[model samples]
Target: MLNKVLIIGRLTSDPTLRYLPSGTKVVEFGLAYNRRYTVGEQQREESHFFDVKAYGKMAEGLGARLSKGYMVIVEGRLVQDRWTDKDGKAQSRVRILAESIRVINKPRTEEAPEELSEEIPSEEVPPEGPFDMEDEIPF
Candidate 1:
């Protein structure tokens, strides 16, 4: 069985870095993911919110570089947090335990002015069409 999860989305809020009593570093943030799909002739889109956290050195690095609205790629595994609620009932929720994080977009400081358009080479963009499932991914 596999439990790995990979997600690319925008940060809904700035990352918060904290230190545990044991001196372990951790960072937590919210991510907003959007998906678009075609149902028959109708196109539909939806947004999903996720709670994500990173630990140790990765958390320190991400906390310094990431901010609200930044696009990032997170690779990790799902963890179920189980505990007793205030009502004394058992509760559980799933969250991502980030093993790695990569910033997808350029940092805000280096971005060109909004009025300027950056032209990307045609080859840089993937063509829109059907794909063979058996084909090896270029990446």
Candidate 2:
């Protein structure tokens, strides 16, 4: 059976990066997608929240860049996690296992200036320093 999904949405919270006992990195985050529809003369809007998980390279690469309010497109498969609670009741939830993530938009402050160096005076331009989170360098 085919079980793939593609979703574009805003992150509801910053992604949490953690290492499993086996030393594998994993990232988890929440996504919110809005749906708008019209039925006859009525207009309606609703938001759907989803839990997403990414592993290994994808996790390490995106963990720091993903924050609340960031917009991204995720491609993945649906998974169901099942476990027994402390009270012995069974619990299960379907979540997304992200295979890839594409950042659609960065926040205003995080976005780089669009103008070329010639557009601004040399004195007014900010000085460049050591590469930080915004840099494309791999971790």
Give the alpha carbon lDDT tens digit for every residue of 1-139 in model 1: 6778899898999999987666667678999899999999999999999999776777777778778987778877787666567777887667787866767774356656233222211111112233224322221
Q: lDDT of each model, Cα atoms only?
A: 0.70, 0.70
Off by over 4 Å in 1: 106-139
TM-score of each: 0.74, 0.76
Q: Using TM-score as the measure, which candidate wins?
A: 2
Query: lDDT at 101 for candidate 1?
Result: 76
Model 1 local distance difference test score: 0.70
TM-score of 1: 0.74
Residue 55 in model 2: shift from native, Å?
0.4
Model 2 worst lDDT run, 10 consecutive residues = 117-126
Q: After superposition, how far is residue 55 of candidate 1 from its true place, in Å?
A: 0.5
